[model samples]
Structure formats: structure tokens, C-alpha cells
Target: MMQQHGQHGQRDGVDAAELAAELAAELPADPVVPRVEAASVAVNLLWCVPGDVGGSEEYLVRQLLGLGEQASDFVPTLYVVKSFIETHPALAKLYPIEVANLTGVDRRRRVVAEHTWLRRRTQHAELVHHGGGTTPAVGTRPIVLTIHDLQYLTHPGYHSKLKLQYLRRTMPRSVHRASVIATPTDWVRRTVIEEFDVAPDRVVVVPHGVEADIGVEAPSEFELRSVYGLGSGRVIVFPAITHPHKGHEFLLDVMAQHWDDPDLRLVLLGGKGLADQRVAAKIAELHLERRVIRPGRVPSSHRDGLLQLAHAMVFPSEYEGFGAPVVEAMSLDTPVIAADQPAVSEVIGDAGLVLPRDPEAWADALDIVADQRVELIAAGRRRVTEFTAAKSGAALAEAYRLALS
Candidate 1:
């Protein structure tokens, strides 16, 4: 818990200022900031948009902290440079480096990232070299970016045009300005190299870590199923946000082909997106209403319950930087059936069943899974153990060291 201090002289155990000071005092050490003469290795995670965590962007923040903590252990003061440091004065102390003036620079950055001068406007270079001095740059120190995916640049329709335009401009600039570039998957690394035209050597591939916020005591399988109005039967789970690129339509098509079996059920856990209305209409049109369930946006905690309830997790998507749900389900001893997409395949490897991206493949897959539930669940849990946080964080730390050295 944090203590707060207001200007009115009121002091509370949770005052924001006390919280900031506490953060400043309680961090692990590193030497990266100290080794660089007069310089600070500040990381730029300002764009870690909300809702990115616990789903796909989990690794980005954790690795930043993990790498930053490691760097601080050797470097000295490693402030977690942010624009909103004032909002949580307690968190401001988290940044041993320095916060940059992140205001109004979006337009300026857009120009540089897109037009491509690769100019010597390397003001951030000195900031890194000067211990962040009195004032931060237009961005934070070390200027590192965790490129989760290049969906906007590659597949524009996945998001809005404005966001795509923003990514179109800011990403290249961020890439160019970034002293270090990290990605969650090898496919994303390659994509960055090809799309941003960066040297393949500069982009670092660090696989994403799973949610470590689970208990050692596995929950009751029977109770878990009952929570979702399900019974001890074969379950194929697809936990994805409802989006077109997510291949929800294809997943539904797959389910429709096999919705008749009393032994099987397709449970979808995601929020309604642009395609939800149509997907619902299609369900009604196809008359398969009772066969599937869309309970919407299951929290990470509740997700554990879902996995315990599920016999198998099916990742039906067109692409991703990393399929978080697949690994998450695996961690809970849930077997997986991830589509053979590049990112998905890279993460799941041989741990789970890899099916082709064909729309109708679920029928055959479900039929096989119906009979082999126990073995599938066991194998899935075994696979998830490979993606432990220590392993993932260590790999990320190595990438940070390589970037700095």
C-alpha cells in the first residue's frame, strides 16, 4: 500500500507523494545507468496503451521492468520514464532515468518517422548520455519500444485508420529513435526488419511470458464447469476478442460444422467488436444458438476458472505477435488447438495441436479431441511449463544487454 500527501498538508498512508517516494526507495539495483558516462538508459513505454496487459501486452511491461530492474542492478538510478508521472507521484520515483516532454510532439514525430530523413536530430542521444540532466527529451531515456505487432502497418483493417496513420508515422519514428527494439515473437522480429527496413540485427525477439498470478492448487474441474453452466464433457475453448482478423467467423463456421454432437461444445469468451452483431445474426441464421456461448471479456482471474473448466483451448486467429491465451490455457493444464498461423505456431510449437488455417478443420479436430480429453489436457499443461517468467525474463535481459553493448 502507498501513503499519500496532498498540498493541503493532509497526509494519508496512501498519499500519492509518499507512494512515489516509496517506489523510489524500494526498487532493485542495476548498473546500466551508471556505466554510460553522464548518460541514462531510459526506456519508452508511454504507448503501453490500456487493455494491452494480461492479454497480449503482458510481456512488454514485465520485460521492461525486468530488463530495467536488471539494468538498474548494475547501472544505478533507473527511473521508469513516463508522461503521467505527475498523476502517480509515487510511480514517478520508479523512473531512475528521466521523464520526457511527451506533449505536442506527436505531429513533430509523425513528420520525421514517415518522411524518412534519419536526420541527426538525435537530441535523445545526449539525454541518454547526460543522466537525463534537468529536462527530459521529447521522449523518455534509452527510448526503447516493445513492438507487440505490426498489424497496423501490415493489416490496416484490424484497427482504425487514424490509429493506423498514427502507427504509420509514430512507429517508424519510434523505431528510428529507439536505442533498443524488442518484440514478443520471432515472426514479429522478422516483420519489423522487413516492414521498417531496420537491420535484422537491431530487432530483438523475446517470447512473451504467461500470467504468474495463479494458484498452485488447481481448482475443482467439476466446480469450474458448473460455473460456466457446463458439465464434464468435451469443450473446445476459443478465448479471443471478437474481431475480423481474429477469425471469429471462421471459428463459428468450424463450430457450425460440428454443433450437433451432444459430447462437444464450443465456448467463446470475448467482448463484442465490429463483427459481433453479424456473428450473432449468423448464429441465428444458422440456427446454432444453443451450441455456442459468448460470455464476453473474461478477466485474467476468471480466465483461470475458464481454463480449468475447459478440456481444450482453441486459438482461432489469422495472426498475432503471440497467442497469449494458448499459453495461458496450457499453464492451467488445458490442452490447445492453435491455428497454424506464424505467430501462433512460433509460440505453441509442438506443445499443442497445430491445425491448418482452413475454416472447416475444427470438425475433424473436435472429433479426435472428444475421445482424447485426458491426454490432451496433460500434454497442454506440460507444454506451458516451458514459458516460465524466469526463462522469459532472462532471455529479455540478454536482449537488453546486447542492445546496450
Candidate 2:
């Protein structure tokens, strides 16, 4: 475990003062105060709005945490908005966090600040890592951009006109500017290279890593019952937001038509999205209002508790860069039954039931999930071992080296 000190401190056993001096020696003389010294990597997190970008937010945080814990040639310092510190207090303790003075919630303001303010802060860094899909028009040179997905291109209708236009304009520029492109899965990596006409060598796949914090306490049974009303029956969790491509309506139909058990309850545990009304209408139309629980974004501990208590996790999303929830469920010993989407199937890798998006097939998978619980859970545990934080950190370090080379 990385030792923590109040606010700013040594990380991964590296002395803060000594590390700073080493970085200073490597960089050219700069007039900026605190004497600007480049960390090996400066992570640009100005685009991340808390709770807004879905799993990608958690994915980035976990990767940073992993990098801190593992041995690496490059060091990372997070340049974030104040809200990021508020959202993830643990990171403040573990990393050398440089909080920007802007509120990241305003997209226009964020974009402006990224180009004008962030450029100065990152001037000395060897490379700037853009965690968000779109990079700023002006950022430090030698960029390593992480494009979570080409969802905006694939599902244009899902995004707003302004966001679509912005992404359409910026994505190409960002890709062309990036020294190396990093994607969470090969599915997304291949799509990026093909769509942008970039060389395969320019893109690298750094899969999402799962490292459960055993020390972090999960909510108790009483808390689950009192808070979410989840103790009446067997719980199947689908933790995706109510987006159209998430296949909530399809899952609802399967539950209404095929799964006849009154005791089986499906918990929808994310914030509302574009498909909220349709999902509500479907629940009402199928008279499943009583069977489906929509808690609509709970605390992380509560989410952990729900997943731990769930009989299984069912990820019916039609698309994903990487089905993190599937890996998360496995890490928590919960069996998984996910849609056979390319990225999801690649992540699952025969560990759990990866079925087609047909109602009957999902129904059959859910039926067998219980009977094969022991074996499935064991396989899931084994599968999860492949995507550890240490391994992810190593891959990221290699990517950083490639960016410099």
C-alpha cells in the first residue's frame, strides 16, 4: 500500500522533495514559481465532470491508483479541477495533485481553461496524458490521448448537437496530434485506428484493471434493506445508466415475459439518462413497477454492498469500450451474465455467460447462472487475476515510454 500523508506527501516510497529536485534537473529553466519541474507525466483531467462520464471516470481513477502502487519508469501528477479532489479525496492523499481553479462542470469554461491555463501548468512535463476522449486545441506537446470510445460517432443521436459538433471537430485533431493513442480495449483501439486512418503502432490497448479494496467497508445487510429495500428476494444488478444502448428495455422485456419468479428483483443502480422515460414507460406497461428497483446513483460503499449482495450481475449493454462492471462483479465474487458485445466478450473471455441479446437466451443464461454459480464464480476469480492494477500500471508506463520515443 502507498503510504499517505496529509494533503501532499511522498507516494510509492518516493520522497517528495528529492523527486521534485530530480525533475527540476531534467527540465530547462522556467520562470514559473515553485520553479516548474516536469513530472514524467502530467495527467490532464480538466474534462472529467464528477458522476457525468460514467465508468470512464472510475476507470481513470483506478488506473492512477494502480500506477501509484506499482513500480514504473515514469511518474504521474494529476492536474485536476477542485471538484475532482472533492469527488475523490483518496486520490489527493495518494498522488501529487495540482488543483486547477476552475469548476469543471461548465463545458465551455473547461475547454477554455484547458487550452489557456492548463497549457502553462503542464509546460514542463515530458508528456501530457488526456484522459477525456477529446483533447484541447492547445495543450503541451507529445500528447498521449485516451479515447474511451467512438460512441459519439456511432451513436450521434445519443449526444447533444453541441457535444456532437465539438467531438466531431476535435476528435480528428486530437488523434492526429497525439504521439500515441491509448484505448481500454482492442475493440476500441481497432475502431480508432481504422476510423482515423492511423497506424496500428500508434494505438495501444491498456485494458481496465480491477483491484478491489478489501479494507473499504461495504454496507451491511441492514443498511441495504433500510436504504435500498433490497432484502426481499434474489437481486440481479445492472449498474449502467438508463441509456438506450444499455438494453434496459430489452432486459425488462425478458424479465416480464420469461422470468416468472416473483422473488427475483432487478436493481437499476445508476443516474437517469436519455432513456429514462422509455424505461419508466416499459416498467409501467409491463406492470413490473414493483419488481424493478431504481435507486438512481448511490454512494460507492452502497454500490459495493449491492454488488456484494447481488446473486449475479447482468450487463445487457449493447456496446462498451470495456465492460468494467463485469470485471467488478467478478472481483466481488458475483457471477456475471453479459451481452456478447465485442469488448464485453473480450473482457469476459469464457469466464461467465456471454449470450446474444435475445430474450430467450438471456433467460436461459440467468436460469443456469444459479446452477453453475460455484464454477462460474471460480472462473471469474481466475479471470480477474489477469487485469490487475500492477499490470495496468506497467502497460501505461510502457505507453508513456512509447510516447517519448
Candidate 3:
């Protein structure tokens, strides 16, 4: 099959890939693929926990681990753990149970660093982790560091002071020492260069790919409405819990200000963090109880269900590495109303409505998007289709080749 190439001469989209198909056709006739596979000599993996365990990290790690089966040319290893699991016991349960991952041991030469409220992983994991190692590295394959975002420095409101310190100290070391430093977007790539002074060539930006075709068992719109106990007005889905960076407060204000409109209903996907309490209170203060639905996390079986039932997706975040929910929503042909920032704009491209951060502004934009569903749906499908496990994983394999060569 053929692919789309941008003005920069990069393959921007995939065509039929007929040549690849021809080889696949030959695979059954002969057995040329097995003996041609190549294996690597040296490697080690370190999984950097970017956020409180969720979509992007899981999607990226799943893709990386799949590298072992997809590409016979190289053997890859992975380390997946957030830096705070040891000191912050409450947060350990948040780690992704869906993937095979390992965490670094924060060895801080001293125990004082590992106290609660003070968190501590190994020194590499400790001073760097703020203090704690959820698990030790399980393999010796070359380590690749995946820094999902550098939000703590750019958007401190998203996390606590202790979480911020761990990022400030350990992230840079991971970036510098990683055989290959991978991020999800170009915005993050630029952040690493400007913040840590790492050369651009050393960093690889591999955006998180959608996992829709992974056989998710999502329900239908009728099933979604029945399960959530809702009758359709217009469904508005936000795949975030109540995090400051997620703009949940802003979303509340936007919906509350327009409470008179009976045509819209807002839904939240995950559980709220400590800061989300105030936002929750604001919803009650506005008397939007019946209008809003906190159905908690939509299971993988129901992500598509939720998306299908929605009239539009409103992802007004203050910051993001690469919005995986936005991608998934779009992949399933749902309309999107995302943030109008540099990184998000780059990802959304010309697909959805990119509006200002103001609640009033977002509210108005949401109206426009709900009506322009066709355009929004088409753009979402187009842009999201660019990111696939095979595409990102193959690109990453190339990066690994360069790093270990």
C-alpha cells in the first residue's frame, strides 16, 4: 500500500501498503521471514512513570513490549513504575495492572528520604524518585526513558510539592542516561531540549497510538445510556478525573454557566484526585447534579460505548504530552472539542474546535462543535488514524537501532 507524505517529505499517512501485503502473501507460500530476523547484543529498560497510571503510559508500554513479537531484528526490555510508589502508599494502587512493567528502586543511601509525605525510591530511584522503587529492573536490555510530560515544571498546579521535587531531580538523569529518550509529542521534545539542554537528535518523539482495534468490548449507545441510567440530551464526555491540569474546574464552570440548556449532559470517566473535591462541590453549588454523570472510569469494554453515545468530546486540559483519550474518541468517529494550545493543536491538527481556555469561550465552542458533528468526526478519524502501534513501534525500533548501533 501507499502512504501520504507531507511537505516536509515525511510519511504523514498510510496508504494500502500493497508491497507489505505482497510479502505477507508470500509468507504462506514460502518461509522467508523467520531466518531473516536479527537479534540485539546489549540492552536495559527503565519505564518512567509519567502520570498516575493510565491510558498513554499503558498504550505506549504495550506497544514497546509488543516489539519483541513484531520485530525479530531486536530484543527490547521495559521498566514501568512511577517514582513515588514507595513513599506514597495510596498511589501504588494506581499503577497500571494491565501491562507488564517494572519500576526503579530509589536508593537514597539513607532512610530519611523514604518517609511518607517525603516519598523515597532508590538514589537513582530515591533522590530522583523523591524516594521509592516499586520494583527493580527485570532485564538488562538497553534502557529507554519515556518522559510523558514535563508538566510539574511548566504546570505545577497539576501535582504536589513532593511530586514536583522528584521530577526536577530525577527526570533529567533519566533523559541523559537513557540509551534512547522517548517522548509522546514534539512539544515534550522541545521541553526536554530547553529544560535539560539535551540535543534534539538524541530525543525521539513517538506519540501514543490508539488501541481501538485491540478488540475492546465496548457497548452500544443504547447500552451506554441504559448502563449509565441516562436519556439522551446531548452527551459530552471528558475522559479525565478531577485534576487541575485536566481543567475539570473549568469544565464545571462552562457547563454550570449554561445550566439552562436542557440539551446537554456532561460525563466524567475517572475518579477525582485530592484537588477535584472543590470542583465537585462547585457542581453541587450549581445544582447540576442530574445534568452531570460521574460514572467513574469507563472500562476498556465501554470506552467505545461511551464515545459512541457522545455528541462531542471536550478535552480542555491545561497541558498534555499527547492526549490519548482525544485520539481514541476520534478513532471511534466521535466529534471532539479539544484545547487550543500548541501541543494539543499540533495533535488535533485541523480536526476539532480548538478554543481558548476560558469557560465561557469553551461553552460557546462546545455548542458549535455539537452542531458541526460531521466535520469534527471526520477530522478526528483522520488525525487519530496516523498513530498506530505498528507505526510508533516500528519508528521506535529504528531509534533503538541507532542507539545501540
Please, what is the whole-model Cα lDDT of each candidate in the order they appear?
0.56, 0.78, 0.56
Stronger candidate by TM-score (1 vs 3): 3
lDDT, candidate 1, 132-199, per-residue tens = 10111243345445666766555666555444454454456567766667777889888888887898
**Runs with alpha carbons beyond 4 Å of true place in candidate 1:** 1-45, 52-54, 64-137, 211-219, 370-382
Ranking by lDDT: 2, 3, 1
Candidate 3, residue 352: the lDDT equals 81
lDDT of 2 by residue, 137-175 (tens): 666879898878887777777765555565666679889
Q: What's each prediction's clash count?
A: 35, 0, 31
Residue 13 in candidate 1, Cα distance off native in Å: 44
Model 3 worst lDDT run, 10 consecutive residues: 1-10
Q: Can you write out model 3's per-residue Cα lDDT over 1-405, one digit (the tens) per residue?
A: 000000121121211133233223322232222211222322221233334444444545545543433544654212223442332332223222211122323222111111211121111210021101111222222445556666667666655455455455545655655556677789878988898888778778767775537435777778788888668677888887566677887888888775357757788887555557887788899888888888876566676778777877789887877777777778878777877867787788888888888776665775587578787787777787777766676766666665665
Where model 2 places Cα greater than 4 Å from the true spot, the runs are 1-35, 214-216
State every prediction's TM-score relative to the real structure.
Answer: 0.70, 0.89, 0.72
Better of 2 and 3 by TM-score: 2
* lDDT against true structure, model 1: 0.56
Candidate 3: regions farther than 4 A off: 1-51, 65-69, 77-142, 212-216
